[model samples]
Target: MSTEKIKDARRMVHWPGHMETDYIYTLGIAGEKFFTEMKNSGRIFAAKCKRCGFIYLPPRIYCERCFEKLTEWINVGTKGEVFTYTVAYVDVDSSKLKEPTIYAYIKFDGAHGGLIHKLGEVKHEDVQIGMPVEAVFKPLAERKANINDIKYFKPV
Candidate 1:
């Protein structure tokens, strides 16, 4: 390529902008009730498959294994084991945080599925798979029917 052609390419201007929008969303049937329980009572709920006895952490309309409609709800224990974990050095916006964040999959006792959330009150070096942990939920009045209602999982 000629130097003049390269120079012309470098001079091309691009617009920098972002779109602004507002919206409201409703959680689907199963999610609505599951999250509502957390918001109202600071409790976790799971759906049980009547046929196979499979319990899903995030309530589902049907069982994935048996393809059966699930309606039974059960309260899952706050205490669980860390199935997996990761230490995040950077925030979601690509900014570095003062302290690294620990995230993990917490598998509650007697529940088939597990919840993925942040881990707190523990150091990155101490975080380990299979560690006993418990969910720390925000107060009922402060909850808004979302996963954030349970702030984080902390070592027991």
Candidate 2:
């Protein structure tokens, strides 16, 4: 509008403080099914593109490469191999943890994608790339339909 009004509006807009609001996040179709299987059956799933034979862990509704809607799901199972690993000596808060935690990128047998999760039941010093591992699921009663349902991967 006018120059004076524009200047006043700019001054008004410049004032800022913490913006607070309540919100909920929804997991779309693919995530819902994936977590449901983990919670209900303790199974890991992968989405397969029938046209391209590409499999995606943390399964998606559409193929990333072919862009085709993916409807075929395969049970990738709990077995995997450690693709990579790291040791965390601190917590998320940067506080030193009681013990170091081992984390690994575990690739499922015959699957294209894999999951990054914590490793347990083995010493961090013993962890190796290509180490065979298997997912350990929390008890059925403790499952909350999320990735944490898998407690961790352990050496097989």
Candidate 3:
């Protein structure tokens, strides 16, 4: 190969864009009882707007619609349908994930909006709108206050 061509190849091999940053972080609040239940009871709870009858999954302390403090807690069903989804080639931190992952908004029955989670046990090509799925929880001991406690949704 010519020396000029060798340098061009080396430049492509050492592309700057290939190097990624690792300082990213996520911060959020988990209400006291809301998180405690997930870690200790393995329950999926949502805050309900007592006045407006709106429910917030992944639980919120207040209602967004009416801007009222949520006063009721509802146990959401495990079964839900895919509202929409996208096949992600990257992980949460924007690093390329090894396996292609399906991220979806699942609308649980009787809920107003869907919660986001991974769709598993289904091929990337098989994921479609309105597909039925059920939440698969992590082991009780493995439960955390985070949304990951549900692990992922699988075809039911």
Candidate 4:
């Protein structure tokens, strides 16, 4: 094991461009199930803690409150309301966007936690707190068992 420390600023090697690495990431048990169900059936799910009866929208493997292993899945449906939202004028790279994007934190009908996704088919000025919305899933063949399966939430 080497314990050498680079104290000189000039001694530190700098890599050009970007550090690129290849890796595989999985969403784990709960997330995979949730997305799979939605991608295949167009139905969203929530995990219910039988001990405390607290439902999680993203479906956790364990309950946050009681630490119970959450295996009971409930159909939370696609209906929800915008808890809050923001209009972004720039992309992830901070470049000016062609059109502003509306992102909203949508809370499902009876779930404790919800998802943060882009809202479509509505103008940013029209998006309001407590505005009803629903998931708009992509065509079955085009889905990849991920959050993108639901293209975006659209105002109901």
Question: What TM-scores do the predictions have?
Answer: 0.84, 0.84, 0.73, 0.87
Give me the overall lDDT of model 1: 0.88
User: What lDDT score goes with residue 8 in model 2?
Assistant: 48
Q: Number of clashes in every candidate structure?
A: 0, 0, 0, 0
Candidate 3: residue 19 lDDT (0-100):
66
**Candidate 3 or 1, higher TM-score:** 1
| Span of 10 residues, lowest total lDDT, candidate 4 | 9-18
Residue pairs in collision within model 4: none
Deviating ranges (above 4 Å) for candidate 2? 1-23
For residues 37-106, write the lDDT of model 2, one tens digit per residue.
Answer: 9999999999999999999997999997879999999999999999999999999999999999998999
> Candidate 1 residues 41-111, lDDT tens each?
77788999999999998789999999999989999868899998889989889899898888898898889
Please identify which of the two predictions, 3 or 4, would achieve the higher TM-score against the true structure: 4
Question: Hey, what RMSD does candidate 1 come out at?
Answer: 3.6
User: lDDT per residue, candidate 3, 50-127, as tens digits?
Assistant: 889988876777777888987678888688899999999987789998999899999987667768999988998999
Please write out the lDDT profile of model 4 over residues 114-135, one tens digit for every residue: 9999999998988999999999
